[model samples]
Target: MHNTALQSWGDSFRAFVHPRVITMLFMGLSAGIPILLIFSTLSIWLREAGVERSTVTYFSWAALGYSFKFVWAPLIDRLPFPVLYGLLGRRRSWLIIAQTGIIGAILWMGFTDPAQNLTMMAFAAVALGFASATQDIVIDAYRIEAADADLQAMMSSAYIGGYRIGMIVAGAGALTIAGLFEAEGSYEPMAWTVAYGCMALAMGIGVITTLIIGEPTVTRTDSKYFHETSDYVRFLLMFALTVIAFIAANIYTANLTNPLKSGLIDAGMISELAGFIAGTLKLAISVAAAILTAWLTTKVGVTPTGMVQETYIAPVKDFIDRYGKAAIVVLTLIGVYRIADIVMGVMANVFYTDLGFSKEEIATVSKTFGLFMTIAGSFLGGLLSVRYGVVRILFLGALLSAITNILFAIMAHLGPNTMMFAGVIAADNLSGGLATAAFIAYLSGLTNISFTAMQYAIFSSIMTLFPKILAGFSGTVVDSVGYSWFFIGTAIIGIPVLFLVVLAGRMMQINADKQAEIETKT
Candidate 1:
């Protein structure tokens, strides 16, 4: 029986390498490229153009759109786009809109000068970020939904592969272009325009993807069929609650809602009442979830039985009951990898400048080599995960990422050698690319399709949260400790993560055992 299960595992791994799975690698690149252009790449450009360091630092706040994307995730989940929705369906519709917005934002920035219209540029960039975040939400949902349970990991790998490619084009490619134009110090227009043009070209991949990849089948909605009875009842109940809340507030404030509205024509109490209701709803949902988890566990031996055979076997959920630690390993490793990268990233440009590398020089070598390394790393990592297994690939990826950080530390200490700098950037991006694909595949294995968007968002957000916080202080850290020590500190931060990965490995084995036991019992 154990041998049979092993055979099944082997077959599953083999099946993952199919052509459908292969396509996701490029899709990942498509999703990834424009992100840095609007954010990190933009930051470097601003800093180079004599924008105040303080202002460059504050511009990071524009990323709030990403952190808060869960707010509009439901809208993307439920609301269809106007004209585009009819043609591309919900998933593709949202993707096209967001991608179009990203292109427009980039083009606008190409034409504007931060020195003359920094405020306008800032607004345009925020719009890009917001659009990018929306695109991510939809792209994630589409990827998860497009494949069956058996294929999600492949999709994840593909997305990462594509994403790394995009990053290379946007990050390193942009830098290289900037160098070409910025050589004479009179090439700001050319540099910025080239950077923006790369984004425009990168969006072509997404457009092609939109054209080629068929939309996932959606549950058809009747526009007005549910409105008469069930919808009206729900509306009335909601309306009743609103009225009662308003009355209660008015009574508490001695009829302030009416008097204020009459005197100042101000809309009163609605916002406060909405907040109160929202809090109550959140609390109620939490309680219901707790109750449901307890009830389900009791019925299913505290570990669910039966695989949810959809697009792919959700490795995360499948192992959650049987191999608890394996799930932790995947999450912790992903978090550590990203956090380490983010911590070092914010300080990288400043480090280059301080080390006497001009913006042009930094852009030329870093982007050209770094982009290719990242793409190679992601592609190879995905190949490895498919050829080997998640655990092995993860172990290798974590080790590579940790070692690469040390490489950067070495480069920092070695002083200003462009070749050495290129080497460090290449290694760093390579590890980053590999780790990203592996991590996404690992995370995808854990999700249930029903909660695909929400779960992925949760994982992606948690991973982003700490790293972003640490990154926020990257400038300050570099300012205080200098570059060499800062890179070394970032390297050291990976130690706990490495330990956590080992712990996760043990958990995966335990999960495998538990799963075997269930198979026997059934």
Candidate 2:
């Protein structure tokens, strides 16, 4: 039996070399090109243009597009394009459309001047974010659907390889390109714009990949009929939640640093702490609403297998039914897992720039060197997952993840030494790469294969939202407390993730035992 298992594994591993599987690399590239451009790369540009740290960090809000992509994942899975659908098929057609949108948006952003018209630049960033997120939904679904279970892991690795390459281009390559275009005396927006245009052109790799690849053969399983009474109730519940989320977002935005810090903010008769008022209220209301909605499903005699599937227009039900109440704890861990890294990510380039490192230094030492480290870390992460089990590796990665930032805090005190910077970058990327691999594995394990696209999108979206939200306030924190203290805060944020990961492991064991008992009885 062991020999049989070994042979099966060998065959599946060898199949990873198939040309169809390798194509995910370029698709991954197409998926990756815009991320750093709109994120850390763009943050670098904003800082150069004299944008305040607060506003620069708020621009991280554009990342909110990724956090909410589950909203559109279902449509991407099921919807076909008007003209392109017949020509390219369901997946390719959507890919082409989104790729085109990315090209256009990146061009628009390239032409816009950040210093003169920050709002328009922000608009450009948001548009780019939306297009990128749409493309990601299609790409993720395509990756999952195109491969069998054994091959899916290989495909995911290839996709990430391509993704890291794209990051290299948009992050390091963009900076280097812009550094070249910078005039002798002053920083140049035109130089950065020109760099963006190049990124838009590189998207052709994806466009070509889509046109060449065959679409996955897919069939729908669930009859997502909206007319059903239970469906209607679920729809109303999700709609109400959506509205509540929208209101909560606006309230949070109005007082972005601390939402309830305003004089008027309150929860019934309970007045809260002075700080984090708005953010706190937003969290409390959103959580309360979610709990109430979940309870309502029970009271209304809903099966809740896919309670909000039809409403959110995603396959959330498959996951909900599988995990039941455990989903909250699972999701909470996911949400906070990367806060240690992501909250600090927004300020990295800015921190480098402030520390008197030129863009050239950042591109070469930080991005380029860090890319190699990240790749190494990624490979190591996969190996560690195999040997130690994914959950155990995850806790170790989280520990390394938190500790790595303390290196940055030390760097903050030491300030701008190139050797020290390289060490920090190496540690940072290694831990980041390790944690990312483990986290993706964890999320993949939880997804139902049939609902892979929507469910995975939901997980990825939640994983990103928390960190981005916290990162948005990072500038405020830095301004109030300074970078060293801010890094310290970011490091401490991971403490909760570590604890939750431990709890999640325990919960997962209980669930596994329950499944085992039921199987034994049957």
Candidate 3:
């Protein structure tokens, strides 16, 4: 009887371990590692090493990787890499390039000393961020394209599970290294090197996974027509645009020179770094304009007519029919959640320190406690999605996310009692996890096999842009207004999302009715 029970359990576990799901897990890890390295973890390491707080805060700009992913998204969407394309096909070729860059950048990070070569470190971090962002675009596309509509929920659940696990390793593990490196008053470099090395190795899992995973079959219908065009024309247009944009960007670089160089000089708010900030902005604008031009080519063709006509042939115009309602809800919730979290994040450590909580206490409660809560939320959300349907669960998760942001505001006003802090962190993280899982599942369901990679990349990229732009000024806001108001504002920001959620739910209802009407007519 014991043997039979054990066998049954093993069988059940095996049934859930689909190869596509396993691939998503590794891809998620690859996607997640560089995120912390470039943003939070990098900030922590710099501050600990006696870098200026402002410089550490400013380095947050490197996260433009997540925001500007839409810029190169078209390339991954349409352009085949010359060397890798022949071997791995269009999708997997870019995946291999991105994964390799991620590993290389991490290794470079391990070798550099912030104290000696902070400029190089910033560049390296940007490289890692870009590679990571690129990897995310391809992996998201693959996960969507590789699976059927029904299987997408499970794939998303597995992907989030992997991403959360990666976060644990990066966040908790890096801090543990920092703590271990601390002796008396300072840190030893060994801990950072080891931590970075491990991250590089972890990224390698993506490189290996790319080799094993099958490329999605890309029919002409699958790839937008913009992809089939001459590479020389695309390259020439991009080059011409790059020249015009670089001139404006150079002015920004000139302004930021002092601030960028300040940690090495003195930390008196080097007014010079303003130029660099401006340059980043200019470059961002140029990249956006170029990417938009590339993306526009797809909609100009008669293929859209074919898709419209073909709609009459299938059961409800094929499962690939746009789920515009779900898309809006998912994107809105994503925008709100990230904006709330990030807008709060820049000031969070400063708030804790101000409240007289020691670094060790903050680390223990926030990182450790938040981790488990998030995990619980993710697991529960996955189970709920499979049981209750992704759309319903997504709506509930978004509502919960809004509720918890309010809870966080209350906690912020109440002061830093350990128990209350832990409570807020738990609630916030759980809601975040639930929303993340649900949102991923919802996005996955909307992707059609054709245009799978490009459309999914576009959606994922869309979701990141607003939050990232808003988060850039989080520090400026907190510095100007103070903490309590900041938290309250963050919480209130969720109100818009609640309305978006209701709108999305109604839209989904309309779509379902329309789909049903079409089905009956056929």
Candidate 4:
């Protein structure tokens, strides 16, 4: 027993030093840097430049590419780059291209002054989001393909560790650089420009890593979807038409819903609820547009029947076939799992600023110090999941995650108390790290290795879609009810997630038992 335990510990420690696992660290850093620049960190920049809170929140939509990347994930999965594919192979070729896009987008954002031209800044941000989301798709696929099943947990941990470190650089590192450049009580556009320039240069780490790493040998399942040149052209055209239709429908729906949303808010409905209804209405419209586009494409023979179905629909069908009726429940759980964290998080930097914390202070406590706390929580969560099982730890994580938001509510009432602020940051990040680790493990388990890229992308994209859409209205909620009530409301919203977790656990257990029985019969 002693020897067995000692060997287990030794094996675990050695996994981190594996070359592929180490490569994920750099890949994760590359993936992590651009996100905060597009969202939370960008919020601080806008707010400081005197952009309206609602407008600042609206900028969150720029990162909507993250939620929708699944739309093009199939292309990344199967489509190969022309020259780069031959030189660097499939995964690295996409990695380099995506990284290059990230660098260019960050530089573009640095040059555009949000105060002078918010529209241009929004455009740049959208570009950055697209590039970053594409990088994520490629990196996720690479992570899955680069190693065997046993190494995945370690790879995920390494990726997340590196990702958080990248966040620290983008968050704390960027803020510190900006603070150093800008004088007190003055907004110097040049300060942010220089800061962002440095960040753009930092993307070289990813580029260099991609150049160094060898491509994983992926054994793609034979697909009849992309055999002919006409097929590729047809797929691209159909994808474009579908996207245009969705965007058009979303715009039309928003125009129709805006008046109703205003009326509800005027009639004593909460702004958060109203905004949520508007977003849901828009989502429904957009989904309908996509379905219509798919149907029309088939009718017109833009692509052969089952071409789109084979590329996009098949991964989803694989999931549905595996889970059957419980797929809906599982998907619902995925969609809502991160709501409490993301909604409250979208406003965290703004909240600190509102409480009169300096950017330096926020960077130090929230970004730098809090990062270590989160790492600790991640390690602890991983360890506990092994001991207590994933489902139980997942439930505990959900409870802790929801409960920690109340700490934020309490801190809001306390008002700019640094000690209280630090404590709250610690608790929030710890729970966030714990919840995220288990949730990712759960997501990783759901993917069919055959559809590693697309299936995982679908899972991740759905994970963020609803939460991000609702998060865009965070400023409206805070503006309506103030920070205390806003935090409390976020906590309240998480209550249903706990019930969903319980249901999912039972569902998985029953399925496992049935599978075990079938094996026994066999």
Candidate 5:
């Protein structure tokens, strides 16, 4: 049995010093490095290169890799890496592979000139996104497997701390380096190249950590499907076919809907809204096609069917079994929880640059100082959750998150006032940190211990999918109605999320009551 006793604040704080928790910090740093490179930092790079706003926004789609990583997660979990597995064991071997990919992708992006060869830059971004997402998968698994349940909360905190530190390095550090390389009043591609090259070099920290760390001792059960080479090969082939089918279906549906989408927009429907509708439809069609392909594969043999059932279907079924009708509500809350933050965040660098802030100014206020504010908020959030409860804190987070957008709108009107910029960053990062802490606790609570890893992966993927999709159109929204209105719109959209949080809180309370009653009866 696991310990359910709550620790005193002193004990809880001391937990961070554990060796395993410290290891997770470095693991998280490794995981955090590539994300901003593909989003905020990359946005700054593209704008400096004279890439169109709409095009830069489109590049945000590269992060769809993170949102869809669940698709290949089972393979990462079960597949044996050829020679490395023999040398380094399962988790470390994958970590090294993923770290290597990140380095190569970052270096590739560094070398590509976005203005001269936008397509090449995009390809590199996509590769980096996928590589980074893969690293996330492996690192998350490693975090869980490497520690006991009692220490998870502490490990998670340490991971977040390390992750934020890594972001500081990527965000402010990259910007400072780029600014140093470039002369004032002019954009030089070489400056960016040098900055990215430094970022790539920074990945060595993760690689070295992976090399030094010992693998978790996992007790393996002999499963014929995973152990046999033939079954693994067959499953891989089927998975590949399913992916191909999804891509084909997505392309076909997108092409077919383009005319209708254009007509709707031309007929005065909001272009952003129309694009969303079309994209959602295409996504549904693609998913259906993939499912059909998977079903067809089942007819050939039982192995692929079993793999699908175990990898995807079973965890979903388990969730539904636990939550029943309320499952949809929980999933909705997860999907929309971060919309206010993510959608606004995608364009933050662009907004700062447009408002006449230099790269150095933006880096200092927004990334460096803001990082500490976020960390402070996270600590406060964690403490508050222990005092009040996760649900109440979650609601507070949602409310504060929505309210902070109004600050952004105010700042938009204030132009590039440095004080106003700093004030806004403080409020936003604090709320963001608090919300993140509460939200992570809520997600962890929802997982069935039996399916902890897989279920968490699915939940995380759902969390980002909608937000990222909307973020991809942020530039379009900004272009349509300017930054002030765009900021206000983001705030308004968050209104529904506040209500959803209340509903979710009530539902969880009811479930807790019922569980308590059942336990009493037993």
Candidate 6:
């Protein structure tokens, strides 16, 4: 008999050659580019433009869009486009809408000079973030529904590979291009604008993929609409409510800021009653607005004449019913699992920049080589997950992610050596890749096929939201404690996650074994 190893290799290779798999790879690139733009790529641009580190850190909140995606994910799940849905089906129609919005927003970001118009830049970033998050919701649902289990593993691998490649191009490639422009006698501010403009053009790849691909037919519990035109009404309600909230907030904040408010309330402190009043009233209005939005949308989205179940409601209830109180454990662990890596990530590029590593060096080492390491690690994690279980891999990933922070702490003292940087980069990227793979597999397992978009969106949103919150403070930590201690603290924070991961793993395995035994008996 031929070697077993060669047979396994052959089978794995065959998984990569599918046409749909190839398309996922391209789409992965599309999905990956926008994030780095809002996260690291934008940070680099900000640093180049003499933007303050704290400001840049806060700016990362643009990615809060990813966290809030669950807010509108239901509409994406069930609502059809007015005209586009008839042409492209549900997934592709939403994909097109998201893509168009992303492209326009990125272009808008490019046109606004951050050095001159930081407020407008932040607004553009928010717009880009929302659009990117929307695209992600649809894209994720597409991948989950595209194929069966084996193919999903294959597709996920391809997607990660493509995503890593996109990260490299956006991170390293963009930096290098900007560096070239800098050498060509261009100012840093202008150079970054050009870089972002090109990044927007890169979105065309996703747009074309949307046009050519076939949308997967989703099976929904509700085949009946509230009315013949109820979806349209619900859509209008969401849109109108959103517009009103924005206008109201804008008008209120404008009024508060202008009344000769003594220089915008001194950086971070709110000394004036007007400022405080506006903030409190805004928060109250937002709550009332959410309640109103729910009531109105429920009326429009659900049947008025008979007993009706809404798309968003049942999926959540299904999740809660399945997990009971254990759902808290799952969600909390997910929220914390990536915090060590993600929190450090906000300051990572800043660290490299401060450490006196040139953009070119960072591109070459931290990004280009880092991409390959992450992809390799991700593929390995995916395989291990299939062979063993997501729980084991998940626990291992959490442990390793925490430990890797120690390596960064060491590097903090070691200082600017390419050799050590390469070594640490390899370990860090590998562990992060493994964790990401395991996490995705776990999330995929959690989703109900009928409500994949809503459930997965919920999972993905919580996954990022907590870490983004903690990461928002990373700049403050570094500023106060310095990078070395900040990194050490980051490492220390992972201890709680390690325990949570182990606990969740044990609980999930026990449940799985019990279910297996029940099935066997049946």
Q: Taking the candidates one at a time, how many backbone clashes does each contain?
A: 24, 4, 9, 0, 0, 0
Candidate 3 worst ten-residue window by lDDT: 1-10
* Candidate that scores best on lDDT: 4
RMSD of each: 11.3, 6.6, 8.2, 4.3, 4.4, 6.1
Candidate 5 residue-wise lDDT, 79-160, digit = tens = 8788899999988898899999999999999999898999999999999999999898888777767765545555666677
- What is the C-alpha lDDT profile of model 4 across 1-522, one tens digit per residue? 001122255565666688987898898889889999998878989988889999998988888888788888988877778789899998899999999999999999999898999999999999999999999999988888887654565667677877988888898789889999999989998999998999999899999999999988767776776777788888889888999999999888878899989998999988778878877888888989987997899889997888877888899998998877778889999999999999999999999999889988997899778898887777666555544456666788888888999998998888889999899988988888878877776787777766777999889978987898789889988987999999999999999999998897788667767777989999
Candidate 1 vs candidate 2, TM-score winner: 2
TM-score against truth, every candidate: 0.66, 0.72, 0.75, 0.84, 0.82, 0.78
Candidate 1: lDDT of 399? 72
Alpha-carbon deviation at 214 in model 6, angstroms: 3.4
Ranking by TM-score: 4, 5, 6, 3, 2, 1
lDDT, model 2:
0.76
Note the residue pairs that clash in candidate 5: none
lDDT (Cα, tens digit) per residue for candidate 1, span 220-321: 332322224443343334324433544344345533333443443234434334444444444345445444543454355432222111111332354455
Given candidate 1, what's the lDDT at residue 82? 69
Question: What shift in Å separates residue 282 of candidate 5 from its native position after superposition?
Answer: 2.1
Residue 391 C-alpha lDDT in model 2? 78
**Per-residue lDDT over 250-359 for candidate 6, one digit per residue giving the tens place of the 0 to 100 score:** 56665545553445455454443445545556556665666566566557753342222456577888887766566788889878888999999889999998988888
Find the candidate with the highest TM-score and give its number: 4
- The per-model lDDT (C-alpha) reads 0.66, 0.76, 0.68, 0.84, 0.83, 0.77
The residue-by-residue lDDT of candidate 2 on 11-71, one tens digit each, is 5445457665578879878888989978889998888888999999998888677877876
List the pairs of residues colliding in candidate 3. 222-450, 222-451, 252-275, 252-279, 255-275, 256-273, 256-275, 256-276, 259-273
Sorted by lDDT (best first), the order is 4, 5, 6, 2, 3, 1
If both were scored by lDDT, which would come out higher, candidate 2 or candidate 3? 2
